[model samples]
Target: MATAPTASNLPLFYKDLVPLSSVDHADFHARPLDSADFLINQHAVPLTSDEFVSASRHYPIVFSAGDNPVPLALMGLNEGINTFVSEEGKLINPVYVPAYIRRYPFMLARLRPDTDELSLCFDPTSGAIGKFDEGDVLFVDGKPSDAVNNILEFCKNFEEAGQRTGQFVEELQKADLLMDGEVSIQADGYEQPFVYRGFKMVDETKLRELRGDVLRKMMQNGILALIFAHLFSLQLMREIFAEQVKAGKMPAVTVAPTTA
Candidate 1:
């Protein structure tokens, strides 16, 4: 099956992306990411399987639509509505921030479709990045600085986590446990309930019917807990919808009964 494009398919908040080559970006430096307002417009963020435990505590974790499903942490139900991010871009909730977000402005990318090699890249348009008089330098004496090395390490870790997440999804797919998910919420004074769709989720019935050996293997590998975390997080969808209503940012759409 062909893979579907994900929210992270292209680097978000990246206006201009250039490979961090010593010859090209020799004088580049990176300023501290002091604020998170950049994430305010992001309604959903990609998540690695490792983030399920902590992410489930705050955002609802669901699978993105695609052949190779990627987990997503939903900050809000509607577009341009990140309930966790304040107007100031500060995170309103004290929850585990996904590594995908923390590694922003810096990520590993394949410059060409034909190549398997990944390069360290950064968003040149980000004001936080530049060759300013004061900031962490990207290279020292033509060599990568400690700060640059640290960023590389973080991106490497993120890539590894993504691979693990892919394996988890593959296991679920092999078991045929994923199904289209929907949720309905009732708001006061609203005659009909708001229904949301277009996301994938684990089917509890199929999961419960798995072979004993398969279930034990999943438990031993800790995938079972992650699955449960995702299931439990679905309840937060209603809460996120309520937050949108409270903030008066809910999109104007007709409410309809949920389909089976």
Candidate 2:
């Protein structure tokens, strides 16, 4: 029998997830968000396989019919918003986010390319979220009447926040830090002639079929591979922690872990 990989061996475990070649913007459009589509369509994600197994094995919160069902629009919007606050952190400094990433444990997040025009999916059986570059922006998973306007508003916010994040990451790229890296940035939000420090940000809206082009490239390279990897890592982290507890390697926490 083979021994399972542990946290100590996690660096090797995740090494395979990295691309053998540089992941360029062109490649991202083709792949269009790695494993995220499998877990949930552009419209909905019921529960992951691991989530289902975990839920079946443990008790979770239950509600009555009178209780309101969780709004999918809110769920989706909240996901983006949470990522913004977490990854970008109010844009205090263009360099803060990347600096934080190097100093601490942070979750990874990805948004499909703006040009793809793909949005929302809902199959009670297999929910997903992706781009639809060919069509006018439409929320298909649920009724646009139900979540379309909401998601559009969220999309606008997402674009704005993404630009800010890009600015932050750009600063990191210019820094001398040993771990400095370039974040995947899509020129989707830059509109109007905006000049900062004598450099003009390209107007993404003017690019014909740019979002679709970006989406196509992403699909080729493995869409949102890093984000999905982080999600899977969370699951692995739990498994490793549980195993460590069983082996009496560390004490369990009664209070929540402190955060900065």
Candidate 3:
């Protein structure tokens, strides 16, 4: 169960959102994505179901803690630390970028809770959007321009992917396959290892005990493969931890007893 995203839960760098409208933003335009420095501080980026395979190749996909468990790509061991991003805001490695990050500055959000309708919105502070004389126009002839239409299409696809991700998470929860997640790393010259917890992972024991019909269904639906991808990606936790050490950002505390 993924937690409902609130304004607080919205990704970093998104601030002062206003619904995009032809009437209000007739002259709005967007510049090219010139830099990725904004993503430097994000240690984990949300992952949609469609991203599992490619994301698994680059990042350790793990479920966030709590009743609502959104899949997250671990970029760093600790919060506000993205080791993959260099000082210049460029990605340090050639890893698959999560759509959540790629779709930034533009998001489909429900302006009100009573209605299910979503509105196209953007971060006014993002600097990528403005009333620029050059760049992709957001509106033309009192209607959305091609750029705006494309952004809407992307948002629509993201919403659909989010729905699929939710269903996948629901299946995992229904089968009670989730267990508390933990990881430990012992960096060189460090006597005690650093331990990380407060996440969830598939319980292999529970998964193996699933009924034949359920297992078969999961396999047929490709959920089983996704599960394995998640499991396999856990091995990257050590790699991420090592990167943190190399960056001189290792945690100060020593390992403690594993927590659930």
Candidate 4:
């Protein structure tokens, strides 16, 4: 979820934020971009529960270790190595690109601490928006253009989905279903297996032992499918490790995963 914007703690990929204004940015336009150089060294991205189904197909959906854990999509098992994306940030293959990635440069954020209202903001350093000669215009006749409107709508939907995701995680925590996660990948001719940790996952035993009524409620509310999606995606952890080894980015026999 997009959170408060500040000088010291800008979110991943954002260098600075400025609220979009029709008067100030009347001539600014957005250009098409096919790459994200910012994601080069990032191993994990914030994922919403709504993305569990699609993201589960490409990345292992797991929880961060903390009191208020959020879902994350693991792009790689080792540090600074993303298997699906190239070193330059062009996606290496066709995969489910996360909305968090797609929403780059544009996100809903509160502009002031005194107000509860959120404003449309963009990372000015991205270079994706400017007074470009070609590409989508941000404003027309002092009103937001269709392209800008679409971006706002997408950001709004992302924030809404974040709320639902928080509720789902709260349920998991209340049920005591999350546990520290561990995975060991043994490469050929190696005596010791590579151990990866620093993440959390659902406790399958606890999930199976949930009361029937609770399970029924989860199913009725679509939480059951999301949980299963996360559980099923964990199998991809080894696949990611193999990819890291193939790319020569794997650590020496054993190593822990990057906590970030």
Whole-model lDDT values for every prediction: 0.83, 0.24, 0.84, 0.86
Residue by residue across 1-260, what tens digits does model 2's lDDT show? 01123354421112122211122211211111222222121111122222222332221111111111110110011111211122223421132122111211111223244564433222221112224343233333332432335444544554454454444334323331112111121122333321111111112233233457654653564432322332233233233234334434332222212111
| Higher-scoring candidate on TM-score, 2 or 4 | 4
Best prediction by lDDT: 4
Query: How far off is residue 204 in model 1, in Å?
Result: 0.8
Best by TM-score: 4
TM-scores of the models, in the given order? 0.90, 0.22, 0.92, 0.95
Error of 4 at 146 (Å): 0.5
In candidate 4, how many Å is residue 112 off? 1.0
Q: List the residue pairs that clash in candidate 3.
A: 1-68, 1-69, 2-68, 3-68
lDDT of 1 by residue, 48-152 (tens): 998899999998998876566779898888667789989998878787888988888999999999998998998777677887888998898899999999999
- Model 4: worst 10 consecutive residues (lDDT sum): 1-10
**Per-prediction CA RMSD (Å):** 3.5, 23.4, 2.8, 2.5
The parts of candidate 4 lying over 4 Å away from their true place are: 1-7, 257-260
Model 1, TM vs. native: 0.90
Considering summed lDDT, which 10 consecutive residues are worst modelled in model 1?
1-10
lDDT of 4 by residue, 58-136 (tens): 9998888756788989888765677888977799888998999999999999988999899999999898998889889
In candidate 3, clashing pairs total 4
